[model samples]
Target: MFKRCFLTLVALSVFATVPASANGAVFDMGEQMIEISPIDGSDYYTGSANAQAQVQNTGGIQRTSFKQAIDSLEAAEVEIREEYAVYTQKYNEAKGRYDVAKAECKALKNNIKQINNRLKNVEKTKKMIFNNMPG
Candidate 1:
């Protein structure tokens, strides 16, 4: 019962996250160069050859046909954040379940100990009775 309530609370919290800000920075591409908007907190993409050349020479940046590269990076960032949330929620639930199981096991161990103690006392009492009995 307690476990169910705890899980419900966790689920509600996880699903209740507010959507990310819609003002995601946009990327603009130019001939032989990539133009990224919101650069330095403004919405202008300078069309300079040196800048383009610099971006192009960089190995990974150069690989994609400009448009796909920016899109891929943006998608990866969003995915990373989303996957992190999912994995974290699952981990917390698993940890909670493990804790509950551990507690149950401890309780069982205590019960076993108590039973053993009672059995020992019974054996001692029986031995005393036999010792006191007339032959």
Candidate 2:
């Protein structure tokens, strides 16, 4: 139970850190209001006006072609597959070691039980011989 809880906490921590390392910072803008007003008293403007607009680029989005997107996804998939293979191999090796250790533990426990039984029999024999000796 302790091991299970520890592993769960570790998994949660790993998952939590993953999103924290994302590209952009998180902004919490609560209750925003925007109002646009024209300088003219009239509702509509008839004259042609020269307008210049400047946009601050925050590197939020990247425009990519379909082929580029596909290639990126394929590369990600290849990396995922390689990582999976490495982790799977490590898991298999650990499992093999665990199995060997479990078998050795079982054998050691059995040997201990046998030695305890022999000790009990030896004590009983000693008691019997003492009782049979002349008083």
Candidate 3:
């Protein structure tokens, strides 16, 4: 009788320690949501559908499936690609303008150099003419 009572007590204690429900509670933390489920040492998923429904009903917490997440990422990638293309076009246009401006500046510098050389030649000719004149 004592052995049977001790065995029953141990069995009750073990069962009592186990949680009654495997589905956990979800906590809404303002921007994020967290779900804590009791690990029942089983690979079976019992609450995935319910969790998905809850996620859909709740607008703030976005728990998406793998496919949905991938689709969203792909959409974002396409948008980024379009933006990159636009920026690349703008950069090419700016580069072309810069090249044109740089060429103009180089031409201006060459013209200034030529003018200085001509001025030096004129000064030399004037000195020669003055030396030939009397007094």
Candidate 4:
């Protein structure tokens, strides 16, 4: 039937792909990979690959350069973050000191007002005593 025909076609296809020799020795069906050329303007693998050696070297150089760029950027990011943290800490300390100083200034103003009121009272007492004691 149709099933037998399908099985026969599959068997034939498999046998066709299988390499054979006169002595029936099958060599490797090694890695079958496709090589895609680098696209223009892409950050990845770029450089004149006119020769096989150049193409191989381009791959290695591209990877190394890209890795170096990433490492440098990461180092810069870390430095910037550390500096930001230090600035934040300094700002917090300044804010705390400002608050303390503001509180001290308020307390001093209250103390000065109290001292002025006492001085006014003392001046009034002096005037009353002088008015009564005068001949």
Candidate 5:
């Protein structure tokens, strides 16, 4: 009995140490609307946008604040892709990574007020798109 108890305890400890995928709520799929302003002297007074969404979480270890940072990065990536697509009319793999980094920098560049506002509004924006999704 004592041996069995020890083994069970050890097993439980191992399981406890193993990190589980995040159980906190996440959007299955959602859309984001972004507004892109034109660069001066650009051919078109171009404004473009893309659908942004979150399909997965990187686990719960990161705080909501940090995850928001990541989400902004992902959204920025999508934006960059849309821009590249518009300009070149061709796809390049590196554009995606550039967009992501741009967004991460944008989000991280701000102090608390701006960051908080951006993070807070993300869910609302996501839900708005989610609700509008086709049946």
Candidate 6:
């Protein structure tokens, strides 16, 4: 079970270390909203509401923050796809390497699909947020 725990930690580290920064820039959300999270190495959003509600609360910074989240999601999608490709190729090449065990490969494919679905949801959220914003 050490292997399982180790793999879980590795997987979390792989994705969590990637900050969702927009063009390597940080957002000035506020002191209360910008705490650094020890678990993910990201700015921990302290608000009780969802991203849209939080955006609404931020008022003037809504558009930029929404765009930043969208960009971060897109970056994550790309990174997930890159990792998926490597595993897919390995799976195709030998069908076994211990590193790309059959079950692990299947899990990776599922993760890739999940990331794609997440991107779609993010796009939909962006549209909804944009439409609701006051002109």
lDDT of 1: 0.81
lDDT of residue 59 for candidate 4: 80
lDDT by residue for model 3 (11-128), tens: 9987876644322322234225546668885788656454443334644345456668889999999999999999999999999999999999999999999999999999999999
Whole-model alpha-carbon lDDT for candidate 5 = 0.75
Per-residue accuracy of model 6 over 1-135 as CA lDDT, tens digit each: 999999999998877766654324445555447787658746777768645633345655888899999999999999999999999898777855664787898999999999999999999999999999999
Output the TM-score of candidate 5: 0.21
RMSD of each: 22.7, 19.4, 23.9, 23.8, 41.7, 40.0
Residue pairs that clash (backbone atoms under 3 angstroms), model 5: 32-52
Task: Report the lDDT of model 2 for residue 104.
Answer: 100
What's the TM-score of each model vs. the native? 0.48, 0.52, 0.51, 0.48, 0.21, 0.28
lDDT tens readout by residue for model 5, 81-111: 8997777744344688789988888778776
The TM-score measured for candidate 1 stands at 0.48
Clashing pairs in 3: none
lDDT of 2 by residue, 37-61 (tens): 5588688768987896877674444
Q: List the residue pairs that clash in candidate 2.
A: none
> What local lDDT score does residue 36 receive in model 2, on the 0 to 100 scale?
46
> Which candidate should be chosen as best, given TM-score against the real structure?
2
Off by over 4 Å in 5: 1-62, 90-135
C-alpha lDDT (0 to 100) for residue 55 of candidate 6: 32
Q: How many residue pairs clash in each candidate?
A: 0, 0, 0, 0, 1, 0
Residue 85 of model 6: what lDDT? 100
Model 4 alpha-carbon drift over 4 Å, by segment: 1-60, 132-134
Compared with the true structure, all predictions reach lDDT values of: 0.81, 0.85, 0.82, 0.85, 0.75, 0.82
Candidate 3 or 5, higher lDDT?
A: 3
What's the lDDT of the predicted structure labeled candidate 3?
Answer: 0.82
